[model samples]
Target: MEVLERLFNVALVVATLRTTAPILLVALGGSFTTKAGIFNIGLEGQMLVGAFFAVIGTIFTGSPWIGVLCGVAAALVLAFVFALLVVTFKANEVVVGLALNILAGGMTVSLLKAIFGTRGSIFGHGLVGLPVLRLPNARDLGWFGQMISGYTPLVYVAFILVPVLILFYNRSRLGLYIRVVGEKPEAAEALGISIARIRYVSSLLCGLLAGLAGAHLSLGYTTMFTENMSSGRGFMAVAILIFSNGDPLKILLGCLLFGFSDALSLRLQTFGISSYLVLAVPYLVALIALFALSYRARPRIIQETLASMGRALSVKPNAATDAEKAVTRG
Candidate 1:
């Protein structure tokens, strides 16, 4: 009973919010690309590059906001490269993304060694972490205050983006265009919408959000840059995108589910569970959620596949009839 109480307290909620912020930000960014028919597998690299630059900027500029800008800028540059390669050069996005992830890992480590002179992690006196926001008089509200207050500004930004994105997708012209481009590129192109332009825009947006996520990780979540500090949150964001199918509301729910598992894992560590088992909690939960989602959708997927096959078979006879009619006319 005590363990259950400990596991389900206000503190767990706070922890979940913190843990979810980075993943939520990345997922939100990926949602744009997903909606535009682009599968960006390079979120991990973008995030890692952003995290390194964020720390570097904070240490050099003495401001966390500048750090965030640096991080975003770096990630944007990478995103542009991704766009160029995939959109213009006709490179495979998945391969390019994977290469970038590897590059980011190696590049960051090299930069860490070259610039900071100490690695494996980098932290010192001059690094300025992002400030936390404390709502005025919120502490007086008991558990509600604890849940809502004391988060960094980025955390608030991450959550606020959910509704904003939902409105964008449902009510905005550009959003409609993106969806059209993703679902029916041929039709969009026929309507004079530039597929490449929409895709580039979506990729950049993904990079921007991913940059913010990385900045939050280094500046708000922790004031240090450890090697590979992103810790697969980028890939996790991709999973969320797949699970939610780019819907902002569903993305939020997925983030919360993963976040809750993460928090619970930490809480469980206090009960003397194996660290390895506890660490697996989030991924384990993710697999189960994915399996359940797949299982639930299996019937629909099979029906769609069979229906498409039926259409294809029907088209063959119709094509033959049309050819025969043309011969008869001739």
Candidate 2:
């Protein structure tokens, strides 16, 4: 009991915030594409590209902020290509997104080899990581301060954007335009809204948010770039967006859930569990959540299936009891 309590402490909550920040940010970005009626699956690749560029930019400029800008810029360029292909040329979104992910994976590795004469990963001097927020009176605040402060700027920004985005998603003209464009392209067209333009904007915003996510992964705590470091986080974000249906509050809750799972998984590893099982815990939770969401989406089929299963499992009551109960009710 003591062990379990220690494992699930304030520190775990703090770690969850850091663990969830990247995916949460990426989900927000992906939500835009979802709302705009675009099926974007290239978030992983965009994030990978962003991570690489962020490292490179920091290496050259010795400024993490410059790295962030470069990361976003690189993601925007890729996003434009994606928008052009999918929006203008009428390419399949899933195919384009998958292709982009593959391209990013290959390209980042090749660039690493060419630029640093190394393969797989890169790290060293001049690659300034994003700075942690040091509270002015941390000691005075005690344990709560430890949990609340000391995260990177991006962490705070990601959380702050939740309310801001919720407001924008419901109230802003552009948000409404994107929704109309996605849900009813014909109506949007009749109202003089350009479907292609709205989609392009959506893609761009997704890329921008993805880039921030990638940058945070690479620079939030360490100035290092690893191959395939995103490790399916983009897919997780997509799944979350699907489950939430672009609802900001739901997305936030989903991020917290996934993030807590991830953090807990890591904590459990210290208790002598198998490393593989520990790693799979969070992914398994995500898969289950996604399955549940998909099932819920098909309520009629699920209800019928459950009813059939219940009937099959149920045993018949005694015939005498049934007769007596019926006669008593009458």
Model number with the top lDDT: 1
Against the true structure, what is every candidate's RMSD? Answer: 3.7, 8.8
Alpha-carbon deviation at 62 in model 1, angstroms: 0.7
Model 2 lDDT on a 0 to 1 scale: 0.90
Q: Point out where model 2 deviates above 4 Å.
A: 302-330
Cα error, residue 147 of model 2, in Å, equals 2.1
**TM-scores across all candidates?**
0.92, 0.89
Residue 226 of candidate 1: its Cα lDDT?
98
Candidate 1 off by > 4 Å: 304-330
In model 1, what lDDT does residue 306 have?
Answer: 100
Compose the digit string of candidate 1's lDDT tens values, residues 19-58.
9999999999999999999889999999999999999999
